[model samples]
Target: MGLIFLGIGIAGTILPVLPGGPFYLVAAFCFTKSSERLDNWFKGTKVYDKYVEGFRQKRGMTRKEKIRINLIADFFIVLSLFIVDILFVQIIMVVLGLYKHYYFIKKIKTIKPGEIE
Candidate 1:
């Protein structure tokens, strides 16, 4: 399971249609539950540096990255509204979408990946 999410997250880093950061986070979380070796291996990988390191360190992401992630999350939420038929589920998804943007904008501090300033 963890390996699967880990694979998707790695793929997501290259594929625009998939959101890499979230998938990596999920994979990391899942890995922690199973093998410390797996988690450490991932942390040592370039994918971790590219997608999860800053956020994991509480340093946040670049403004542009945040926007891209939020928009991708919103797109999936809206897509779910069509895929799911229950009004309550749809409403929950909408709320989650709005909360996604709100959390990124309000709760996080943004920083570029390699800016010295």
Candidate 2:
């Protein structure tokens, strides 16, 4: 999964249509959970430093990043809600979606690119 996300992230960096940041973040997370060596290697890369370092440090994301990540997540959640007719699952999805927005809005401090270095 980490390698898959890393591949997508690399491709996203070259492709105009795909956004790289979210995939980089997922790759970093997967690498961290899977192996210490992989996590260290990934964290040493420019991609991880550029995309995930600030978020890891609790410095938050740019407004564009927050919106893009939220929209991508919301799309999948809504798709699942439509596919699964279970009321409980749908309710959970709604709550989770709300919480995601709230967390990003309140917990993450939006900062300027200049603030990063």
Candidate 3:
């Protein structure tokens, strides 16, 4: 699962359609839970440095990064809204989507580029 997300995240870095940041974070979590060795190995990789390390150190993201992540998340939320028939679930997803934006904008501090390093 970690590797799968890592691959997707790597591809996301290259491809515009996929959002790499969230997937990289997920991969880091999955690796941590799976094994210490795996976690350490992932942290040592350049992918982790490029995607996750800045967020970790600065505790925020650049405006461009935030926008990209939110747009991708919104896309999936809207896609799920069409697929899921349950009104309750749909509502929850909508709330989550809104909250996600709020959290990013309000809760997480937005930093300038090159601020992370």
The candidate that achieves the highest TM-score relative to the unseen native structure: 3
lDDT of 1 at 30: 89
**lDDT for every model?**
0.75, 0.79, 0.83
Q: In terms of lDDT, which candidate is strongest? A: 3
The estimated TM-scores of all candidates read 0.63, 0.60, 0.65
CA displacement after TM-score superposition, residue 74 of candidate 2 (Å) = 0.8
Count of backbone clashes for each model? 0, 0, 0
Off by over 4 Å in 2: 1-39, 44-51, 56-58
Ranking by TM-score: 3, 1, 2
Which pairs of residues collide in candidate 2?
Answer: none
Task: List ranges where model 1 is wrong by over 4 Å.
Answer: 1-36, 56-58, 112-114
Q: How well does candidate 1 score on lDDT at residue 99?
A: 65
Report how far residue 16 has shifted in candidate 1, in Å.
14
The lowest-lDDT stretch of 10 consecutive residues in candidate 1 is 12-21
Q: Candidate 1 on 46-74: residue-level lDDT in tens? A: 87887777778756778888988776666
